[model samples]
Target chain A: MTNSIRAEWTKFRTVRGWVIGLLTAIPLTVLIGLLGPLGSSFDCAGPNGAQCRGNTPPIGPDGTPVFDTFYFVHRTLTGDGSVTARVGALRDAEPWAKAGLLLKEGTTSGSRYAAVLLTGGHGVRMQYDFTEDIAGPSPDEDRQWLRLTREGTTLTGETSSDGRRWSTVGTVRLDFGERVELGMFVSSPQHLETSNTFGGRLDRGAPTVATTSFDQVRTTGAAAEDWRGTAVGIDPAREHEVGFTDDGGDLTITGTGDIAPIPASAGSLGKTAENALVGAFAGLVAVLVVAALFATSEYRRGIIRTSFTANPRRGQLLAAKAVVVGGLSFVVGAVSSALALPLVERAELAEGFFQHPTTWLTELRLVLGTGLLFAVAAVLAVALGMFLRRGALTVTAVVVGVVLPYLLAVASVLPTGPAEVLVTVTPAAAFAIQQSVEEYPQVAASYTPADGYFPLSPTGGLVVLCGYAAVAVVLAAIATRRRDA
Target chain B: MSALHAEWTKAWTVPGTAWLLAGVVTLTPLLGVLAASSMAEGGDPARTSLLGVTLGQAAVVGLAVATVSGEYGTGMIRTTLTAVPRRLAVLRAKAFLVCMLTVAGGTAAVGASVAAGDALLPEGLSIAQGPVLRAAVGSVLYLALVGLLGVGVAALVRDAATAVGLVLGLLFLTPIVASLVSDPDWRERLLEWSPMTAGLAVQATVDLGSQPIGPWQGLGVLAAWASAALLAGAAALRLRDAS
Candidate 1:
């Protein structure tokens, strides 16, 4: 065994390709590792931006500021038993007005009004009374408050007791797609002859209030795209809604009509990038086949005898071949990873780049681990080649071993046990290493995400990857020993 | 005629050739079906079903490489050459035999993949669909082309281990590079020009417009690679003395 190892080492060291391949793997692994971190960023809003910016203040249909500026003012003025405030849209307005208007209590009236202002086809009125009530013989007091928002035909009303926690009070649907108005008016039924005004009431003026805050107000997100005359149906029964953005266009689904809304976060973007990598990397078979050919090419030239004569032990000859093949694969894998890093990193960065101290570790794991995986695949190829003692046979076995599990993973056999186990343990395990999301439950046993976990923990994936490589290596070793080269 | 008969007999008598072909027939679609089934449970059935093609092509490539490389490893190439003095004729004969066998095996494998994919996929994934049909048929052709590539590479390298390594590197290196590269334009170019990347483009059922190369064009790339390898191998065989 020692002699064989030495012989293998000698052969590997002498091959120029092996040296070049190793040099390539190191940088490639580093580069590919860098892609994930470069693409991600630290958002103040966790995951999907729930806290970032909830809603926009409304705007006029013509794109002008509806309410000048929100302010809180205090004043006192004499008034009758009732008062009225008039609110309406500006002239030459297109159809609807969108904005947030707040009315708060001032010192004069000693009354408080907490409300929002909005106007559209769908509208609602929300107001709450803040004054302490007298027991008896008191006139009923009615205060008008404005609170509303409009998005296309939909108008939403909100109420807040402590500004921090806001809740929707009610929703109203209206056919008014055009301009509308809103205001408050008060009236007193008593005539002048019926009673004289009291000293304090006659001297004082009407109460004044100020607006506290206004934000995210807009009037433009109301037009839905017209899908008339198009072959595609807007809301077909079979269609799956993927995403809807008032920013660009209407909601679009896949051609087959199944659409799932993609989460708006770096994690989702990372998964997308990873999926693309998996799809692209699936073509690695071509590379493995080429490597296998090189390993077995000597047999076709009647050089196996010469190779065996030089090495003496068949095991040594096979070991040398495995080392050479695996070494080349490692180089190729490393180079590929390096080149992919910048591309992947840029793609991730486009979403939002974040700096994480742990990112370096993740990169290291991905690059080196990926290189090792490819190396194991190469070793397996050599072992298969040796076992079959025929180039085609070895190639077939290796390809079957590599590719069959993937197919079986998708095949619909009655009992899914064997297939599942096969997929979980094979190249699928290798893929699990690439995951940035929680290891999928069915395919991964020991790797589970934490509570409220978002994506795959990078470290856990590395462990699973190591497991895959170890298995492949052990299998290759066993096959090499059991089979004739 | 006698030499052709002898070659045919020799190929048939080998247990490895039959076993390899059988594996191609049974394993390709079986794995495709499995992948499709697994994918259908959670994700897209068509995409999952076609997943096996990626792995199956590797096997096909291996099979092709072994066909030529095995002879080299066994030190029988010299004997075969002595029997048939015309090196080009021997190469041509080998190519013809391998192509015929690969086509037959590839057809079976592809047919099984489609059948299994259709059977194993979820109810919504219809194999009768145009894209699915294209993927299935293209997969067969893809395997055949991969086999030819193996044969050519094996001929050039003349060492089983080296030939396999070189072919796999050639096939897989481009996509890896394309993936790792940061520039979209460069990545797009690499993906478009890479033989395997271009060839596998035929498997895409979604977002054709976004593909680096058109499906037919991608297959053309693989064909070009195969032709080049064959030409190179033929030249090497003609120029070099047999061991």
Candidate 2:
């Protein structure tokens, strides 16, 4: 077995053109990754006629980009306190407008918090830590009572139609000190409108402000000082858009911006990590040519008969070939992807675009998953070469099967539904390995594959492509045994 | 003239040529049906119907590459070159034959695709319509130019698999990579420069202004790619020794 493997490796390295073809994948990936960012630039007018950089959304407790701007009217609370508010009317509300009572550690953005809120469309919801959401029962006639209580480190959110009776909306544990900011708050996310046209998706978003009138506001274990109103994460340019008016006990707070995780598709100025990996397709094509020719050229020259004479076991020879091809491709993919990510990010940064925050674990997964994707695709190409015993047909079949489906699904005139289905069913699903941004159910965004939100998780997508490669290898092995080489 | 006759005979004699042409015809409409049926509300039915051309172009590539590279594989090119002695004429003959067959297959395939669209999609697609007719004829021309491009690349690269891979990358990958650009002007420039994206722009019937490139102009860009590839192939044929 080792002999056959060594022979296969020797044969691959000996061919000048094939070696050059495989190596070309690395530079092609790096070059395209670097050049794609050069063409894209972003600029916005800042305060006092200065140029504004891209959005720098706060990083949440889970280390994801989050919108943390809202209006807060608060008083300091000691240990084990609760805030209750009657949401009388929410004016000029978007569907995701929030008029709620919140308990937070401080007035800082990205701080740990919990809230029970009345949403413009969803009635009542309890959201905590930017990423968690729980729906409560429907409100009657836009009127609801929201309450948040702190018991030790545990936070409980409850909602009621009347101020007297309350049902638990959600319970979550957030570690905080004895003193915290308990408040009445209002927030509305940017209104995003997406319309599908002939070729692509069109997205337009505008800042929205929602005003909530809160009466009968009460807090337990609270300080006696007057309630302070502040707008967290408000841009100075848009400061006038957020404010609170208090007339005796009735408080009206109007706020712009959201308090949820940034959706991968909208309401953020950052590009996903996969935007730098667009060169993968170019690299994959180069590796595919070499992988196909590695097997088919031997048949073209009638060298397979000589190979079989030495081995006498065709399956081992096929395995050896697969190992060599898969290993080379994996190395090329991993190295190129790892090198391209930072370089492309730097170039995009120079052009005023920021990368959405992702954990070190997800970044590692992307690098290794991309390597596995390329390895499997190359193995599939070699298997296809053995199965068909034709060079042009093998390369064409794999490219059309793999790359064409991806281009049609993500870049062409296909609609989102069909495009998602195309990626899910076809080998092109492997590209999902590069999806660095995740879909958040709490955020309303165009979560389509074209926007880098794949239907399948990263590992699930790699498994689908591996299934194709495995089946092809089995068929190729059977054909090799049955046919006279 | 004898080179043309000899090339014609050689083309008909190969069994794979017939199957490849059949693939061009059948696969085009088959995928066209899938694309047309998958479309949602408010799209150009004419363009969606012609989406099958994207798949059919693969078959066109196969036929054209096989026509050039198969001879090299079998060592038959040396024999033909000795007989004809004029290598350029032989290449011209091969190019002519490839284009002729691709047009025939492309026309039938595109007609079936449009007919299937008329049945599967909403109204506003017919052979009598001006833009639809232009799209239909332009698709046939597009397939022919793809064939010429394939023959040229195959002649230059000489290896069948490498040539197919190169041509397919040029046809499919450019538009995909182009779509990744976030700059509107850059994206438009990239689209205008891509052979498949520019040429396929002729399919649009509903919104002409929104298109990256105009119909005839897009086809002309593809024609430029084809001619340049042919010129390179001619240079390679003139410079290199026949194996």
Candidate 3:
């Protein structure tokens, strides 16, 4: 065993490709890590605030709010506009609502009002235009109301009666990194000398017949945590207005500002470590592929007979190859992880490092854990290669084993419930270990607290990933021991 | 003609080549269809349809690596050398065979993907658009070029696994590293030059203005990498002993 280990180490050091492959991981990890934070900076403020400044408002040049930035509201109508009442009459009345104009008795022109509320630069708003007249006497009759709210790029709209019970109207998305706004205005078509009335009777002796109320307007920042047990409201617009109520410890909202960047977070560090392990495992596939070719190359060249003459023990030869390949992979994984750590740490610190000691421990565990995964992969690869004895078959099988499950996970042909579980069980499950987010939608169903939905627990996801690795290793080992070299 | 026939027989007789070709055929289109379907369900067709190409290129690289590495692994290069004696001919013949196979396989994969995308895409995605067509066709060519890179790496490394690793690392690692890097300028430059990133530039349909490298130019960059690898491999093959 010692002789094989020493021999393997010698071979590994001699191999130019292994050296290059191992060294390559350092720059690669650093590069990908840095890009995540550098892409864009988020401003939690909208157009009319100090955060915006000379910076282009999250809206377009035409003053339309960009979809992802904030909820925009313009109470005033643009172009040719007139407010036609549905269930109410317009009257020249004294001001009733704060931050808006009022219509009084005998008012000829429509009342116009516009207000833009940027949800502290987080979340979206739904737009509501109450001007579209409802033709029927029924209160449930369809009417145009503009309401907008955003989560990521997704925007939802809703309408309400008395600002409480809301009905969903529609949803849409604008572009990323753009501001959004809502506009409201009321206008009458009648000449200035003539008075137009909607709703109740208009008399000079009494107050005007029509009145409209807009209240309970609110927006809350969408939680950045994974959607699990959170109620996802159908009304995309009013969803922002819905607040969180704690349930079991299962569903929690760790706001964006509170959560550390990926490298700094304990969870994120674990994830990166897992990623390194997976990468090392991937590299082990390469080692196995090469080793199989090396072993078989001798056979195909009729040199195996000579090799056996020199060293009669077939197991010893296999052992030497396995040790060499596995050792190389271990060194490669460790060196790569070690080299990558400082760079990733520096980048994370640039973003703001987590001060907790637990975070550092998680990061350390992640790096060591990744090294183990690579070693395992190397051993599995060599064993498979030795068992198969045919270079082409071994390489094909190894490649398929490594790559196929990942492909299956991403392909959504399976039924949603089963597919979600299956996807989480495959490479996606393994990869999910790299995520800092407590709940990942790719692995499980997510819900908002205001909306009702159940998702798999994070522990469940980890078990599934471990299951895949165990199954793969066992299969490879079985195939290795049973097959002739 | 006999040499071509012999080479053809040699290439096909090996189970690895057949399996790899089959993988290229089935996996690429299947991935494309799946991606398209997923995207269509989510209301974004283009990103979904082209997803197969992301993974398919890796397979193409694998296939290309196997072309040269298989012969080296089994010690068949010496037999071919004895038959043809001219080292350059063997290299040329292998390159030609692999390129033709890759192009044909890549075309099938890309075509199936595009067809699947067209069938599965939501109402808004139109296959008739010129730029979209270019992206689709360019994707096929990109796979072919990646295959060439694989072959070159195989020749240089002379070990199937090492060659595959080196090529995959070259193709995949740079982009990953570039992504991890904190500096935008370095990342942008890496994205422009990284073989996989540059090759994948052909897939950009939506925001042409924002891409680090232009579509055609990205393809050209990959071609350069392939050419350089092949040249280096050919040189190595010329200087090295058959064993």
Candidate 4:
């Protein structure tokens, strides 16, 4: 058995095609992973790791800043209340630039807040926290009256095209405090530069300022009767950059600001860690082709006779081949994933994207788990080859089983429920092994399968893939034992 | 007519032909049922139910490739040539037989897929009407063209692996590679022209307005691809020495 295992290893190493495939799978995996984030060209100066370790508002778990920065005017509200403002047109606004009435927990970026705001170009939008963007009616009126009413933690947004009849936009339940900042605010992101090329924004955008005025500002809720306005996010060094005047019934505010670490979903892992596994599909395809050919090529060349004649025992041959292919794939997958993840994380950080750094253990699991996924997938591919005895068919089976489902599930084309079901059943379920981000119950998000979630835990998903592989191997063993070479 | 009849018998007589054809019929609806069963409300039932065509095409390609390449593999091509005398007629007969078989099997598979989808879909999905009918019939045509593509590519490449690789790669990889295009216009063009993307468009009935190409137009693109491959294959057979 040892001799046959040694012979199998020797036979595998001897194949130039297999060696080239393994060698390419590594760099291809890392490169593909890097390419996704690189394509986005993430640019931000939001969170410094050490500064965010404390998870200060605006700063996320790994010190990446959540979008929490905005000027505020307030009187501590004890109970249910409302703030109404007739918002004047914003000047030099961005598409996502916002100015409207808001009820916020505090001055921090990630704190719970919901606002009915007039956007620069896309019309009215209702946004809560940092993730949810609910579209409201696009009334023809340029100036609109917006109201945000709070009842417990639930905030309802209303917009009036003519300040006479208010129409409900939407309401979101948020976690908040009794002493909340409720008032009107204005913000504009950096000036965006459009590329002549077709891909995403290639240049880091320049910052721009926007000023918006509010007329007939009034409060009816418990905290709104008496109001004091203060600019919370104004850096002392950058004094006079952003300000608000709340004199009597009217106010004007201006600033070049946005909640930091803007809203971009890179799986649940965010941009920082999704890079770790982005190349996984690219690498897996190469591995599938090589692993499948490892079995089928012998049949194609009619060397199955020679292989069995030398080994005599079909089970030993299968076992030895499995070990050799599995070990080789593991090594290739691990090294490539290791090289890709760190390089991508660094590049994202340099590009101004803010992120909480994954722990060493999380990183280790990411790299090693990818290795295991490919290893098992390769073994499965080999088994499929034994069953089908066709290079194209077996590779297609494994790819359809793994890669295609992963793509479809993540395409955002399928709705949440079906996408989740897809990930649960297919070998692509193994992808859950690489998930490092935990979904918080309090956070409002899509939380769909397309958003980097598996219905089963990572280990559980991997177990699903393992189940298919075990079946294939058992069938291969039975056929090899019973059939002629 | 006699040559066509002879080719018909030749294709099914090959090992695994019947099972491969059966696999296409069984797996198509089985996968379609699985997809349809898992769908949420408001989904285009026609598209979701016919999703199995993506997998079904694999078997269709295999059947067509085996029809041509299996003879070459067994040195039966020499005997086939001796029997027919005219090589082009033999290739034509083979293509016709494979296409007819694909159309027959594809119709069954697609009909089963729709029936399964209609039975399994949670919402009101009418399989008996409108774009659904076009989708079902067009899917059958799509498979036939893909089968012809397999036949054409196999004749050109000769080796089973090489031919299967070429056909499947053209079918699957073009869309993937095209997706990397940053410019939306070019991406749309790439998708519109890609054989697999355009061919599969026939299965899309729900959001016809949003599809890159119209159903018939997309199928036309796939047909154009098949015609080109067949033309190239014919040229190869006429120009190259027969083993």
Q: Give the count of colliding residue pairs in each prediction.
A: 111, 0, 69, 12
DockQ of each: 0.17, 0.59, 0.17, 0.06
* Reference-based TM-score of each model: 0.52, 0.93, 0.57, 0.68
State the lDDT of candidate 1 residue by residue for B69-166, as single tens digits: 76776678888988989888888777777777878888777777767766766654566889877876787778788888888888887766556655
- Local error of candidate 4 at A219, Å? 23
Tens-digit lDDT string for candidate 3 (B1-243): 556566788878877777777788888878667555544144225545766776676667667777787777667888988998878778877888888888888888877777787887765446688777887788888888888787777888787666765665566455544433434566578788988778777777765766779989999999999999999989988999988
DockQ of 3: 0.17
Q: Score each candidate by Cα lDDT.
A: 0.49, 0.87, 0.49, 0.74
Clash pairs of candidate 2? none
User: Which candidate has the top score in lDDT?
Assistant: 2
Error of 2 at A257 (Å): 2.9
| Best of the candidates, TM-score | 2
Candidate 4 per-residue lDDT, tens place, A282-308, comes to 777788778887888788778999999
Residue ranges of candidate 3 with Cα displaced over 4 Å: A1-339, A347-358, A386-423, A432-484, B1-5, B40-47, B124-129, B182-184
Error of 4 at B212 (Å): 2.6
